[model samples]
Target: MTTLSDLLSDPLPSGLGLSDRQWLVLSALPGMGARRLARLACECPVWPDGWLSRLPEQAASALRLWLDHPQRSPFGALFDGLDAWLTADPRNTLLHPDHPAWPALLAQLPDPPGVLWASGDLTALSLPTLAIVGSRRPSREGLHQAHRFGRELAERGWCVVSGLALGVDGAAQEAALNTRGRSIAVLGCGVDVIYPPRHATLYRRLLDEGGLLLSEHPPGTRARPAFFPRRNRIVTGVSLGVLVVEAAEKSGSLVSARLAIEQNRELFALPGSLNNPQARGCLNLIREGAVLTTCVDDILDELGHWAETPGTRSAAPAVPGSDDDDPMLGWLSDVPTPLDALVTLTGQDVTACQLQLLELELEGLATQAAGGWIRLPR
Candidate 1:
């Protein structure tokens, strides 16, 4: 495994004209957000000259003004101890915009990260990718749909990208891994600290299964509410498209879909029941002209030639005994049936019956009305 020390020891490119240490220093500077840094690069005449060792008096004054400002100073303090922490880990790599491995997709965004700390296969960033995002508390049917979509996409060749949160995100990554496909997780916090904590094992498994863990924040930054909306843009920015499995009318996943639209990337929404609050956002998105995705083909067809690659094609035989094969599923018919009555007539385990019912409902085979399951009208 290439260590951070090894990456730092490598000679800087002549075009960058900045030492590894100098790059780190620039990243640590106060008020040096992505936009500010880009402006500084443009305004400075002999760029990257004494900018590192000794700032020009005018630049130094500008830096002082930023440091004295209340808002920018505190955020800069977040990186106060990052340099030493990064130096301690051989595996931690901080990649700047000029770095060869920096993701080219991110550069096209208006506000790309100044630095990215990454682990696992950095080359995966160069591969064609898609982002799958949805509600953290998705229904069981939603999870199944996400997994199915993710697994199919992975088997076909596209790298499944997600936030690694619970529910749909977790299902997507797990499905991609199961199919021996590459996946990338873009974190809201540092890569070293798993935000949900419960997903520590999943995080470890990702490293070996052709998956990469990435973050713009340096190591040691804890997950925070404010960081996620900013983090979401990269999820959309890095991918060729974004797939939303299920989302509430005002869910965070909608933010990702909106960002994908703003980036002019394909936005695919899995159609869900209008009755399901979790599905309302997707229905709304479809109403707004986002592609209504019934299956993986809906997405692949939209990608057109890009998806013609062998990896993006699906050939797996459909599994037997899915919802369509369930005999009890036919009992509900077009009219809603009381839960207790259906349980009595079906004579199946309550949990198993409920699971099937949920799947049927999501597939548009059944509907919930007046506290009962009903078959959709013909």
Candidate 2:
């Protein structure tokens, strides 16, 4: 197997093919945005002649100049910087619409990135993913829920997608990585530039542990206030769903939740205590029709039909009993047994009872409905 050092010594890496190089240049052209590039990508327009007619005047001029005079185009410096960034690390990859490992779900975005800069294993892109986003300054319970959801989702073969920011995003991703599962961090800045600075260790661990870092921006671009809201689209774009563990009334994660809804991806919100300020956004989302999620099974049940992996649909991290043996189902019925009542009857603590209920829900044997948990018709 080729090692990291071996990749570093190689002159030409795998992602810089002739077509990719052209796409990269187009991505840098003036007036070219994701929607336009996506259109052009589908046509695979011929160089110079075909492209010159379709591009905006400014972008056309730049392309013409580059075609005529390769040495002096304004993009030369930018291209050089990109090339240097790519060559500096063998793991760094450029993904375009044509890249084999590119996430097909991104094609559904209203404005998919024209090109993606990525580091670490690209294989993570192929896995069924869920975006776990919420408040950057969460309460302890918010962090705990993020950790729990992240760990369980990863354990269930779902790639946890997040922005790699602090608080909720960090907690979820770290949990996924710590559990030896897969994750992908979509960033507002360059894939190579670690933002938040505090997440430097998480950044390195993500790459080291076979996770992925992705950005639409070129390497070396600094994080900007505007870029993050735009970045939220990509985070939700590639996922089967988005889960807001916690958020204030006006938070970036809410933006992600909206994007998920627009993208037709399932939206989940972790309900928190009414007293917690950070829980307001989630509560609002729940009121707005986002599923009120308590456990990983809630997400799995909604997304199971979208499951691509062989066993992901039915297999979970294993609760105490098998499907038929789960005692929670005994106490639940179509009448919606309130959560406290189930806890009393099962003799298991609240957390354990919730887990079993979630497991039964995952198996389609029970569900949480109006008033409380209920057993489904077998």
List TM-score per model, in order. Answer: 0.69, 0.76
Identify the candidate with maximal lDDT.
2
TM-score of 1: 0.69
Error of model 1, residue 79, in angstroms: 10
Off by over 4 Å in 2: 1-18, 42-44, 306-378
Whole-model lDDT per candidate: 0.70, 0.78
Give the per-residue lDDT of model 1 (tens digit) for 1-378. 111222222222112444444455555576566655544543332544445435546545544544466355433454555666667755556776555555545544556666777767765665567899998999989999999988988877878899889889989989988988888888999888887887887798787766888887777789998989988898887787899999999999999998988766789998887679999999999999899999888886776534454333343212234554666665654444444334335544333456677787787777666425567754
lDDT of 2 at 341: 39
Clash pairs (backbone) in predicted model 2? none
lDDT of 2 at 268: 95
**Model 2 lDDT tens row, 139-251:** 98999999999998888788999999999999999999999999999999998898999999999999999899999998889999999988999999878789999999998
